[model samples]
Target: MTGTASARRSASPFSRAGVLGIVLVGFAAFIALLYFISAGDTGDRGNTGAAHASATGLNGYAGLVRLLENEQFDVTLSRTPSGLETTDLLILTPPLYSDPEDIAQILEARDYLGPTMVILPKWSASGPPNNLPAETADKFKDGWVALGSANTLQWTSELPAPFALTQKIETLEDDEVPQWSGLDQSGEVPTKTIAYAEQSALHDPLITDQSGHILALSVLGEEDSEYYNNAHWTVFVVEPDLVNNYGLSRQENAAAAIALVQQAGYEGDYSAVTFDLTLNGFGGAENLLTLAFRPPFLAATLCLILAMLSIAWRAFLRFGPAAIGGPEIAFGKKQLVSNGAGLIVRARRFGLLAAPYADLSARRLASRLGLIKHDAEAIDAALAVRLPEEEPYSLRADRLREARSSTEILRAAQALRELEGKLAK
Candidate 1:
């Protein structure tokens, strides 16, 4: 017994406090990792598309976004539908293949919310092909596209009631300088062809070219609540080159672009101008992984992290004395006999148990009373000296030996066991 106590305990490689420190630090680091990953990017590819606010292509309007930002205006690239309903200015640059109903639905919802500007797509743009020459590929810039051809949107001609529009492309020669006048500013478009909307009786013209073709149109809602809640102005830019990156290259066009955004949808000094990207397919949807690190849920996530740290602490520092592992098999005659009895029981030999149990009980009682002879009568005489009121051991032994049925054998064995236990006591 002293051997276990006398041995010196080997020092643990890490103490309990050190282990707790490691667990807390590791948990904090894991939480930091999740937070950073969730907050880094909403999976929006930078300046990759041809016409979205995030793109830098000639047909894209990212330059306009930068220009507005430089002018101290709050500009946002909206990836969700909720951003489209801002009570300020919302700019939409939907692709050519976009659904007209979807566009109409967005406008219908935002009728009372804010002023919206729809700059229709004009150029069919694409990236450099795989068969591009090395010199040409080297010249190609990232997020820059090749302007293939000029076109018009089908929805422009099928706008909501009393707002029908149609467009005709006009090719400009190198010598021809077709100037546009709008927003009290004049600018010459930088593209080879200018797509201008034809005359429409339903809408008022904001900007017109030298040919009097409408470059921009503003549909005003009647003050009557049946037609509209208020006098809302929905500006439509037919030729995107008037405000696209190619158009913004000219200082005059840049000024005109900013004028169109501010004068048309001016809300307040700090009212935001939201540029939509969902129609161009850069939408950020709700997700469990993202929500866990965001507001409201972040508090619960932190609580869970704390609970984990507490669990680790409880496991590392134990209470009371350390319990040494016990032997796999207990060291006792009872266990040895139990193994033997289990084997005997498995053999289905009930008759063999009664005689052995009686003999064993007699020997145990005889040894306990210091009797030399282990016979049933001798054990009975010795046990009677210890306790005179007990049943005779010889009588119990005869009954157990003569037992034939399984029930009689079990009953006799139980009686012998009880008698031995009383003598032992």
Candidate 2:
């Protein structure tokens, strides 16, 4: 029975290990959640037939992005406002209904970076709303848009000063279609509706029709003006179909699109292309999730992970034994005294111990001093003669015998033991 209890005691009945395991597991799950939140860009980028770069819809420039990537130019689809502030050539494909001020803000930021291309919208495309039955919604493939009639952007004149957009969409006769040419490549615009921004002194025409209305043009100004003296230039694509997915099926159009991207994005030995998605509603604000994984904060994140690992290791493995427990029923003099003390405590009999403990100390001291008579006066006189500096044994024993609380009894008993020791010395 004793061996059984000792074996049981060896492995703690309390679940110190189990509780620690729970804590470590909880911490790991919390870190995993934080990582998931911060791991990727936020927004719904799924194809809903929008004209942004991420969409494969006919009006979208996704094919243009793919062509740039295939041509080895560094291409990025930016969903944050920060993407606008870069030296790389930025392509803006803002929706017709978007705020002109937002577009102005982007251009103002890029004044130092230099060069941007604004593609005005022409096609009014739409997809079936999801409120329809799921079975019907599933029938339509992703990014499929029903092409509506080409419409002119009415709000283009509301842009920043010195820019006024008077755009026209003309449909030429069957045998009268001539290609627009620039950038050493030429491509035919769709005859059903050919779009152009009316020529003005502010425009430097890069691509144009036979009549010479601007299909694509660079912003121009006086020699000393910032537009002319800035690090690069800005071009506007009046026609949406020139580089959109609708025109990409033709080899000539595809080649022309490639040349246009290179010409616009070119700066140094090598230049990259970036497509803006913020205006198309894919933008996300910078928050804790974004900051934690960047810069000085990234170092802090790694340190936090290391701390968690160290704590888990400490919890999983023991460096030293906690304690070595004794048997259920121990033997010998020490155990006997411990058992007696426990009984006295349980019965509230602390006062009963004082008198007996002092009596026992007196007997032991008398025996040690080689005294025959153990009367109170005799023993005290002997102690006085033997150790003059010590308090007499009779006084210490009387204090011990009268003590009611455990603290008083312990102090009185200690004095008697010290006197006995000094006399023997």
Candidate 3:
């Protein structure tokens, strides 16, 4: 039984079928879960209607729509020109690339039912913010009164970059009057500086005059007396990088911008926010397409996929059989002793001691019987007669009991040996 157990312990699996079976089962479960999460319309889709963008529903906007919603702004997601009507203040985030048609639509509304905010992101040749043409650049300078440059940071504040580049948020001079009233934790307040620029990236004057009304000034724009006057308009243009999700989440730039928008006195606060590329643009083509085509569905699908993959990897891949080594042995001294005795008996070395022992026995018996030449038979007979069971062999026993030195002992033993043979015959 012990040997059987040892053999089994030493045995390896005959084939990999068991391992293969486990792999298949795990893979099946993984695929099933992946399909399930990605299949049906997941709730991760965009919300619909007025309730959707009303802080109640997060329908639209880029770079954290929830931030606006939390502040009781009528934040909505809209991509159509018609959807622009939903908000008085439209804060276009960075990463926006404008076509002529899009620019035309923006210009049409610039005069009256204006967007309170227009934020241009850092443009890169290869990414979400596509590089703008000189025409578009001119429009940005004349229209928004904002500019772009590398992000800046300092020991005193948390801006995204380390050096000053473009104007992000600008603070008005102490003597300048506010262009509008804004809310604070203390309720309604009056001030040109709703918040300080995360870094001092803003140009000397933040407002400019292009088409009569006070517009934002570009960071790189030339200084003109007309743009510096206080009564025209109040603009806070943050460094583009300072207002992104990574930066805004940490600093007060995002919150401050929201406040500024409300102070500008727009009707509703709804916007369809997307990067020039959608959220999916950050990953694979599938994700980009999904975000572009069906953003809500894609969002849900992604969530499910990630969840399923994590669970499957943990539950299936982490499990396996432990390895075993060689067979073992138990101990036994009694069995070893018996085996050694058997080996000695089989060697038949007892004859080597018997001949010498017989001669010695004859000599010792002779001495005991006072017969120096006595043999074994003589001693046997004497003892038997004295013991009273063998009188007939007494005389023979007496003669055979004589033995002298070692040679004599051997001779006497041989004579007794012959007598015993004659008696047996």
Candidate 4:
């Protein structure tokens, strides 16, 4: 008995409090871990693309930004038209200008600005069709050429020897009195020929106009100049292989394209490449950071902080014991049934149930007999008429009397129940 009492005392209010604390703290720690995993590192800092593009810094355009800096020019590579105004001689590359909408916008800007040199690199074909209006196409046709032989050079064979590129050329045409021998098809119109390939095993003569003006010359001997008015406003080079980055990366090809551009009389201030974020109303440096801190993240942070504070407050504030008689206690199933049985036995032993049971049986019997009146006199009369047999009626009457005695009450109740079943049938 003493050990049992000790065990009961050991499970006290303070011990229960400690267990609750462990559970609450463990849950809070789990929640905290989830929050950190989802949020990652929030305070990481680096140069924003806008800041880098605007500062003439090297962080904006990936690796190529370094190359532009090394060449002593500022490049702001932008997606917006207004950004294009910040520099002269825009050098467009793939991807950024690959979309038709962006390309059309850039081309539209050409008429307003000075002459621009478009370098058709090898992968330039991925861009959408210019679909430029016929008028615009004619105006810019001579200026723009796909980098291949049949398009720019008049004949396939007239192209220079010792050089082989990957394109098919059908025929070569002649200058007035120039040789067209052994060549069947006519050459590309002269209006489109800016420069043709001249170096070949066959005599790929360099052809020019009657004014000693060289139309297509060897890529190896391309020249540079300060004025474009010396020729027309536009110059077409049949194969820009001499100008694209793939070729320009090599010393020989790079120098050649630069010289040709210069010889075409393109002189302008080369500085900053701008990146346009105006389409998103996120032009300045703060826009990117603003997007990073939008509403959902803000709400989640607030909820986390509130939960932590609630936990800490509950930990420190005292939790008084639950009040006495706070809620009614519930008995076990067996205990409740036993209590009901005891009440019934006590009522029968004192004969307290005789009057109530007799009254109940009479009313029930009257109801079963379909009699409107259900007094004792009425029930007895109805039973006499319906049963007509005296024995069963007498037995019922005797059982009702016996219900007052403690020992015989159950027998009396059973007889009344049996009579009720018979009447129901």
> Who wins the TM-score comparison?
1
**lDDT, candidate 2, 47-68, per-residue tens:** 5567888777789888889987
TM-score of each: 0.71, 0.67, 0.27, 0.28
Candidate 3: residue 240 Cα off by (Å): 2.7
TM-score winner, 2 or 4 = 2
lDDT of each: 0.78, 0.76, 0.39, 0.42
Top of the candidates by lDDT: 1
* Order of models, best TM-score first: 1, 2, 4, 3
lDDT for model 3, on a 0 to 1 scale?
0.39
Indicate whether candidate 1 or candidate 4 has the larger TM-score: 1
| Candidate 4 lDDT over residue span 1-425, tens digit each | 66665665555557556767876899777766554433332232232212222222211223334454565555554444455454354443322123444444553454345334433222222111369677766664222233232232222232222122222222333444221111111122222223333333221223333333333332221234222113122223333334443333445443444444443334333343333333312232322333335786777766866998788668545343433342353588987867766887766454666556766876787789898876756666777777666335445656667665566776776677776777898
Per-residue lDDT of 200 in model 1: 66
Model 4's C-alpha root-mean-square deviation from the true structure amounts to 20.7
Q: Rank the candidates by lDDT, best first.
A: 1, 2, 4, 3
- Candidate 3 minimal-lDDT segment of 10 residues: 49-58
What ranges in model 2 sit over 4 Å off?
1-40, 43-46, 128-140, 171-179, 266-270, 286-290, 293-299, 315-397, 401-411, 414-425
For candidate 3, what's the RMSD? 23.0
Number of backbone collisions per candidate? 0, 0, 22, 20
- Model 1, 1-425: lDDT tens digits are 44553332223456667777887799777766665444343444544446978778888888999999998888998776668778878899989877778888888887777788899888887887769999998988888888787876677666675445787888878888888997799988786588888776656787888888898888754445443446456788888888889899999999888887876675243357899887887665544467877998999999987997688768876622354556767778999988877887889788888877887887788888898989877777777788799788888889999999889988888888888787666
- The candidate with the higher TM-score, 3 or 4, is 4
